[model samples]
Target: MLIISPQTCTEGFAYDRGSRRCIDEDECRTQPDVCRGDMQCVNQNGGYLCLPRRLYDQPYRSEIPARPEATAQCLLGYTPAEDGSCDDIDECETNSHHCNPTQVCINTAGGYTCSCTEGYWLIGGQCQDIDECRYGYCQQLCANVPGSYSCSCNPGFILNPDSRTCQDVDECEDEPCTHGCFNTYGSFMCNCDEGFELASDGTSCIDLDECSFSEFLCQHRCVNTPGSFSCVCPPGYYVYEDGRSCEDINECDTGNNTCTTAQVCFNFQGGNTCLDALQCHSPYVEVSDNQCMCSAENPACRDKPFTILYRHMDLSSGRSVPADIFQMQATTRYPGAFYIFQIKSGNEGREFYMRQTSNVSATLVLSRPIKGPRELVLDLEMVTVNNVINFRGSSIIRLTVFVSEHPF
Candidate 1:
């Protein structure tokens, strides 16, 4: 070796010429402040230098500086642990935020945000009601609720049960014709017009007849009655009761029998009949009675014991009076006087003679005689006298007759 100086060879501590101080070479282990803040110290020949620390704390952080190898343990907003490491802060669990009271906080990767519930909106970071009615969201009338709204209709209207839409009500459909119910916007009305009367049910209208007042319907004279009238006619005119119309009566044409024998009949108004008498013809001889007779030798009497008669000879000829009460008589009897008589004209011919009479006292009864003068024939034959009879003989014999004119 080389000879060392006596000053530097006292111990391991020595004085260097560059620093000119006694130095302990192992002092870095006991006093680390001897290194620079950014440098590391190592056992070089005999001195040390400064080195940087492994990690550094942030500027505003309150924790100790960290090591690079422990990056996973560093908490962003928290202080370091006693072990010089970091842990999680968990701000979501702490409930510290500026969100609205009615909002919800949702934790994100690095922070949190706020939001409202259903039917609400976030306005300026606060919850507000979404007015669904204002923007026509409701189909009908709208009602507002907390943070929401509903739909409904006003009075006098109804919402359709299916569609939820407002509609007008028809009140007239239920009670139709209620005084003529009229439907309007949301209601109905009731009334009637003039010249009409409302019925008891207030639905129908009725009419009144003005013709029941007076008898203005008839012409000359009027008789007013219930629902009808009549007209009257003057005298000499009779109204037919069937239709009440007037007509004339002809009294003269109606035959009212008022007449006597041998009379002419006439008619008048109100049914009257009249009569006048007739005359008889002249006689061949005047007899003791009111009739005309003939003697036995008279040319009108064809033979002796003479007689005269008159009668109706035809069936069509009507009858005259006293049909069955006449006789011819002789006071002095002649024994065998044969007499024959024949009717000239009228119904009397069938009723006058009887077959049992053939003597002088035989009789002929007259039924009805002809209206004018009529002639008849009789013949008599005198065989012999009964005894010596007196020959005093009157020239004429008379008879009286009564008469009725009609056949009935």
Candidate 2:
């Protein structure tokens, strides 16, 4: 209903004289100085605008303005395929991703994402080694390495099949000790048997040396044996039933003495002796086992001894010196009788001496060491003087001594 001239165009159209019509104007390109600072111009259907420079080139999104049934060209992180379609770019294969060297890159729809590998964590846009020990990865010990971790156990323990737990080691199974062995939670111990002790090396057993600990363990002497001790007794003594004490053995009662038929056997402490049977001399007659008297019918007997006695003794070799061997006592006490005693003979070595203990008693003592396999006959004389009665008499004792060859 209305006719318009070419010169009367609309607000966004321009008059073209050659075509004889109006056309849309490109204000963005024609007006080069339209946009201000930090802004860029965008052309629209009927106008244009100045927008922020950053909003102009958005990645993975359409850069052109929306239009009816129109598609935009490919932006960054995308590739134009041969089928005229846009495809996701594989930055990982092309090594174009910004992920760290220690990180893994995953391809997404339009971009690639960065992630940490095992034993590592993403921190501040970087892959850091994770401390597995802080999380109790191993039961006893833990060690973390690059991109991996390790599990271990402490000493004296072995790792279990799972490689995370530990079990105690049984060291006693190897029999490390000589005598005995004991196993504990994480170690072993060594022990010794009775009458033995553990050595300094902790694996050997040594004798206890029981004899050195106490002297009373044996009655007479102590003999040390391996793993045990024994008691020993001296000669003429035997071990009692208790196995620790000694008892004197009577050689005379056991008929173990070496006395002949002409002698009589007598027993003393630790030894035996033999005495000659009673026999009268030419001027004397036997009265008893140990006494003798002179016959008055013989006139020569008046100057001789009134009586003679005989005795015998046995001694051991290497006997301690100054030993009291015999004691002599008067059979009958007399009033106002002064007595003098002396060794008349058989003391060539001066080994013996007589000590007068009282008016009626005397003792025989040995003063020096005397060895055996020898015999000695001693004549001991006692002279009695009665001062009040004016009478004097003498008696003699013939003593025979046998010394043995051995000490015990």
Compared with the true structure, all predictions reach lDDT values of 0.45, 0.76
Per-candidate alpha-carbon RMSD to the true structure: 38.4, 19.5
Error of 1 at 393 (Å): 75
Residue by residue across 1-408, what tens digits does model 1's lDDT show? 112233532233465566554444565676666677665554322333343443223332335456654433442335455665554344556786556688776554223445566566545556676665665654668877886666777665787765447788887888756346777777765555543456675566554332344444332245544334455544323455653554433333433354554544443211223434322233245443233455556564543333332221211124454454434445455554343333233334454542225555444555545442223332221222333443333322322222212121
Q: What is the TM-score of each candidate against the true structure?
A: 0.26, 0.62
Candidate 2 lDDT over residue span 254-315, tens digit each: 98889998888876546677767777877788888887888656797887777788887777
For model 2, the stretches where C-alpha displacement exceeds 4 angstroms are 1-95, 106-113, 121-145, 148-155, 160-167, 184-186, 197-225, 231-237, 240-248, 255-263, 268-276, 295-297, 312-325, 366-378, 397-408
lDDT of 2 at 191: 93
- The segments of candidate 1 whose C-alpha lies over 4 angstroms from its true place after superposition are 1-94, 107-110, 160-164, 176-408
Instruction: For candidate 1, give the lDDT of residue 292.
Output: 42
Q: What is the lDDT of residue 24 in candidate 2?
A: 60
For residue 305, model 1's alpha carbon misses the true position, in angstroms, by 72
Q: Candidate 1 versus the native: TM-score?
A: 0.26
